[model samples]
Target: MSTRLIIMRHANSRPESDTGLDHDRPLNEQGLAEASQMSQALIDRDWMPDTALISSSKRTQETFALMMDVPCEIRPEIYLAGLDTLLPIATGIEEGKTTLMLGHNPGCEMLIATLCGTYHPISTATCALFTKDGPHWVLESVLRPEALDRFKRVPYEVE
Candidate 1:
């Protein structure tokens, strides 16, 4: 059976905080605001995931937390990950009715570009939605923060 994947970049964060704890950085003000807005859009658009996987980073963890009732798994390899580190996760996923993969970029953008045939730097909180057709997931549509605000339909919601 096809397993859908929704890849989301962690919200804005203080990457330059004096705290050297890369895994402890919290979302900045804008990040929290964006997360609030996106959370609503996701709810309105019915984009909730049954299962969520995240990089074992602070920012990613916070992003996963904003969502409701999503069981989360932490993956260290996903931190500052590249496509290779992400491909296996996408291909190996099983048992989740719908899956949310939250992590950093360029890995997050790179993975979606490789699988979806699109390219962008993936601004914080951007998400690329993919649907599993047969044995592989296909790019159904893309949504950024601006689009989410405008169109809260499913992943295929048009501009």
Candidate 2:
């Protein structure tokens, strides 16, 4: 069995005006719903992670909390980290384990490109699933909140 990696960007956060610090910004209401939707999608796809590496930022932490219940390590250095900071972590995952990395872009975006040779935008609440293929990583799927049916809004009728 090959190792699998799920790279995800934290859900949308409240503006810095509300938190006074970028690191302290919390998820907005829409972000909460997006997190919940993505959580179910992961479970349904049987992509539940065995372990997770999460950024220490409040938004990333909250995003992980709403999405998963698994062993996780919060790394302060992951906040707004780039490929130089994240690639080593990805390369070090034990073989055959599924690990999730919840962080920000363009680090998340950079990781996907470095591993898979393709770059997909890592938007709020977006997940890029990658599986190992021989000596390289293969991009499996990219899950976005906007593309999930559960997140679609039903038109309201005026009574």
Candidate achieving the largest lDDT: 2
* lDDT by residue for model 2 (1-159), tens: 679999899999888736498899999998999899888888878899999999999999999999888999999989999999999998888889999999998899999889878667778998888899888888888888888876552221112
**Predicted candidate 1 versus true structure: per-residue lDDT over 1-159, tens digit per residue:** 346788889989986655778778888987886677767767775677888889998888887777556788888888998888899898777744778889988898889888866675678887777888776667766666655554443343422
The alpha-carbon lDDT assigned to residue 86 of candidate 2 equals 97
TM-score of 1: 0.86
> What lDDT would candidate 2 get against the real structure?
0.87
lDDT, each prediction: 0.77, 0.87
Model 2, residue 123: what's the lDDT? 83
